[model samples]
Target chain A: GQQVQQSPASLVLQEGENAELQCNFSSTATRLQWFYQRPGGSLVSLLSNPSGTKHTGRLTSTTVTKERRGSLHISSSQITDSGTYLCAMSNNNAPRFGAGTKLSVKP
Target chain B: ETAVFQTPNYHVTQVGNEVSFNCKQTLGHDTMYWYKQDSKKLLKIMFSYNNKQLIVNETVPRRFSPQSSDKAHLNLRIKSVEPEDSAVYLCASSPDWGSQNTLYFGAGTRLSVL
Candidate 1:
């Protein structure tokens, strides 16, 4: 069973638009991570924000540990961002993953 | 920048054959993990190793074995390939065992069993 849940299993956005992805967990997580994967490609670590806000490039990740919720905001969506955004959490040694948010950017 | 490397970006083998996938981490992280992605785009954790101890997901078959020679390398060995094993195997490493540690992942090895 999946312990982590990510909303909008699939999303499509126009070029230059903004997009937000949500991740919620069923259990308290000691650490939460966000990753991006291109179709039939490798995964790139986007951020590791457990209970705070973090930013890199055009991506911003915010996490609220108490609420077991996290969000990723993408500014100026591009075709390169069209892929799967995966959310994973770890508590102790066991790690769990959400299905993922598939994003498609239209030009 | 730290990197995790997985060999055999793509592999095809016949059923009953043995195959092995290798993983290496140059980040010198203490934790490494193996995840499997099905055709449905669902990713599931297969195994996790922290220096010494190995944690295996209960759903994984007995034919799937994970071997770690050291802290920087973790390898997956399949005793007998099966059609059901055809999927993507991703290798990832973390700086620590903590939940907040960022995971650096390799591109992945796509396996196809005929």
Candidate 2:
């Protein structure tokens, strides 16, 4: 079975600080995506990078397919950024998710 | 912008009860999926339908079933729910069966089985 593992299960940072999240998959993946979810809210796709690096807004994601690992970096964190960051990967079927990293940006 | 919609944001029922959750996607995606999020926020894929056809059915209990009337609509029905069934049911849609497309998720329906 395929598995996705995320690091730093929880993170807390100041408003102006930075945050980095890590994800590793057990097997090869054709697609990798990062998602954000507020408490009791829906999952919002942040970035989808199967390989190399990609950026959007204050978030950046880097994926190394051969290594089966990825990372999400958040810069200039804001209080509203407090939520959960999820990493999902798929080979040829439905995507499977990691346990998710709970992030809290303090004032 | 919230193209996927799920009905009954929250549901509360007792053991041995049956419940159904409805999901619709306006994104015109050809594939829809049902995922379960436990209290620990561990997500697992339960079912997937592509163009109104059952494509991927995980090792879910036989009491759980999925219905797809069209490519845009997929529903989940759970019979004789148990305490372990209390979790959030998320509906998502992608453009196709492959991994090239990104998923659009709904708000999800929270179920409480007591």
Which is the leading candidate under TM-score?
A: 2
Q: What are the clashing pairs of model 2?
A: none
Q: Give candidate 2 misplaced runs (Cα > 4 Å).
A: none
Compose the digit string of candidate 2's lDDT tens values, residues A1-107. Answer: 99999999999999999999999999999989999999988999999988999999999999999999999999999999999999999998999999999999989
Candidate 1, superposed: residue stretches over 4 Å from native? none
Give the per-residue lDDT of model 2 (tens digit) for B1-114.
Answer: 789999989999999999999999999899999999999999999999999999899999998999999999999999889999999999999999987869999999999999
Candidate 1 lDDT by residue in tens digits, A1-107: 43899999999999999999999998888888888888887888788877899999999999998998999999999988899999988777656778999999999
Candidate 2: TM of chain A?
A: 0.98
User: Could you say which candidate leads in lDDT?
Assistant: 2
Q: Candidate 2, residue B5: CA error in Å?
A: 0.7
lDDT (Cα, 0-100) at A13 in candidate 2: 97
For candidate 1, the per-residue lDDT at B81 reads 90
lDDT of each: 0.88, 0.96
> What is residue B53's positional error in candidate 2, in angstroms?
1.0
